[model samples]
Target: MSCFEILDPAFGRFVLGNAALKQLATGFDWVEGPVWFGDAGCLLFSDIPNDKILRYTPGVGISTYRAPSNYSNGHTRDRQGRLVSCEHGTRRVTRTELDGSITVIADSYQGKSLNSPNDVVVKSDGSIWFTDPHYGIGSNYEGFAADQELPCNVYRIDPDGTIEAVLTDFNCPNGLAFSPDETLLYVADTGRMYQDDPAHIRRFSMESGRPKSLGIFHTIAPGKGDGIRCDMDGNLWSSAGDGVHCIAPDGHLMGKILVPEKVSNICFGGRAKHQLYITATTSLYAITLNRVGAQTP
Candidate 1:
């Protein structure tokens, strides 16, 4: 089978003709949250069901980074180079301090506990945005099953330590990422959790500190978008049932890099951020890309 399905000719520029998707590691229960640490020359990802965070080094292979990670799902580095995480077990967004202590950013809004924090992204101004869905709390696999006290909403934690609900209309918002220039924010709404069909991703324009849904960004044909990241050119690479779907800045289909297993999340790492690391169902995959990923900072 072809390794990629390029919808537009422009998609050809981001991929290599001889680059094949390689499974870096496997045998985990559920793998997600792949983040590259260029400074450490390693990659860290979560195996949610196993409650572990695994690390992969260049010469070395996979090793347990942290066990009992509190079911960390999504991860990204902040402006200060701290790891920001969305924890399902704790139902909160946390920042991994330089000394490795966990600092709670948000747990409850208006005295009501959050449902489950899924994905997170740090903005340029040090504000944190994350999706709080019931995915982690809905079952006993990822986290302890519990009642959802708050509705599934996309929230923003200001630099001043104030929490605000930016958008409260999603059924279960999943992955989220900002555009290369921070002009737009894309969020995935996996309707499967609500038994809804035709799962789609939405793009919101950030002009006045308020986000308004511009419209549907892109719709996956046979799968749903789970985790998404943007390349330097504002091309969004989102996790699909088949693999990762690359969407253009104009919300047009770019192409897909097929993975053997269903992918959950992805991030750009490696020296120049040209390597794409993916977290699939039970494995971790990576491939070198001709184009580099958009810098979150």
Candidate 2:
């Protein structure tokens, strides 16, 4: 069967190649939140249902990076090269220091515990941003059942260890990332948790260390996106049920890389930042792309 195709039409000829969709690992409940560590030459992702974080290398396959990971959902590297994670089970954002020690960056705001940290990103200025929804507390599936006392919001943790709310009033915030220039922020509204439709990606202008002038970017699948990243050219790569959709900066659908299972999250890594690692349901996949990823930190 053919897995590659190049379309010729009135617009132009665009090539869609399946150069990498092989499953390197399997037998997980649900996989999400992939991040690339070029220095370590490996990819790390969260398997929420399994309550673990897994690491994958080209030749070594998959290995346990962390267990009882507090049901971490999203991950990214900080400007200082530390691992920043959003913990659903713990209802907080955490970081892993160089010595393998964990630090709670943000857990409670205004003396009340957060709902559930879903996704996270670190700006070039060393500010850690993350999303909080009730996914972790709504049920006992991903995290412990607890009372949600605050509105769903996005927060920024400053270098001095201060947490500031950036945006509030979202049904549920899922995937998120800053543009290559760090001037714009994108977030996926995967509303209605595990349902169809009502799925849209939104964009906000980042100014003076906050988000402003929010708007819609694009929509994905019968479901919404989970994790998101940007390429060097400013194009967005988002996780979708069908595969990974590469959308242009202007919100045009360019093409897709198909996966046998539904994709939950993705990140760019490899020696040249040209590799796209995908976290799909029950498996992990990767491909070498022609473009580099943005240096968020």
Candidate 3:
């Protein structure tokens, strides 16, 4: 049986006919973020419910990278190659230094504690962008339940350590990524989990160093968009209930990669950045593609 549901002819060139989707590992409570460390030849990800960050190597299999990781959810590398992460348990965003020290990036805004930090990304200018949602604090499953001190919002941290709420209108800003040239930013709003809101991704143009909304980019069916990433060609690859949806630059569904379980997040990795690493409900999966991920800066 075919592993893909091709919706448009353009998507055919992006996929490899001989490449088979491979399940890398399983037995996690709930896996979310997946980041590639090319220099170390490993993939690091968050197993949220387990309160651990797991690492997967090409030939070494899965191992514990960091246990009791403060229920971290999403991760990315800064331009300097240091790890930047969102910690649900701590309700903060942190950066892991080369010497193994952890630096708190942002935990509060305007003297009030922020909602749990969800997903994160770093721009070429050394700025850190992330989502603050209540999912982690909504229950005791992923993080400690507590009163939300701040509204769910998207934030940006300047290289000088100034914190600002870039977008304030999202019900729940989940995953986000920048376009190839960093001219456009795509953010997923998975507010349907709490109310009768739309489950879609919004596109915004960078104007005056802030995001100017371009309106709803695309809405996901079957399930809401949980995480999203962009390819070098400006295609947005988003996570869905059934699998991963590849949307073209023009806001059209290009194709779908069928997964047996729900996908929470994904990242382009491997030697040439041609391997798409996926973090599903209970397992980690990957498939080779004919595309490369957008380089940082």
Candidate-wise lDDT, in order: 0.89, 0.82, 0.93
Model 2, 1-297: lDDT tens digits are 533222223112222255546687899988888888878878889999789999988788889999989998899999788899999888989999999999999999999899999999888898888999788898888888888888788888999999988788678888889998899999887874555547788999987878885688988764467788988778888888778777778887777777778888888887888777888888888777767888642
Candidate that would win on TM-score: 3
Put the candidates in TM-score order, highest first.
3, 1, 2
Ranking the candidates on lDDT from highest down gives 3, 1, 2
Residue pairs in candidate 1 whose N, alpha carbon or C atoms collide under 3 angstroms: 231-294
After the best TM-score superposition of candidate 2, give how far the Cα of residue 182 lies from its true spot, in angstroms. Answer: 0.5
Taking the tens digit of each residue's C-alpha lDDT, what string does model 1 give over 140-174? 99988999898889999999999999999888899
Q: Which candidate is the best by lDDT?
A: 3
Better of 1 and 3 by TM-score: 3
Assess candidate 2 and give its TM-score to the true structure: 0.92
The residue-by-residue lDDT of candidate 3 on 22-103, one tens digit each, is 9999888899999999999999999999999999999989999999899999999999899999999999999999999999
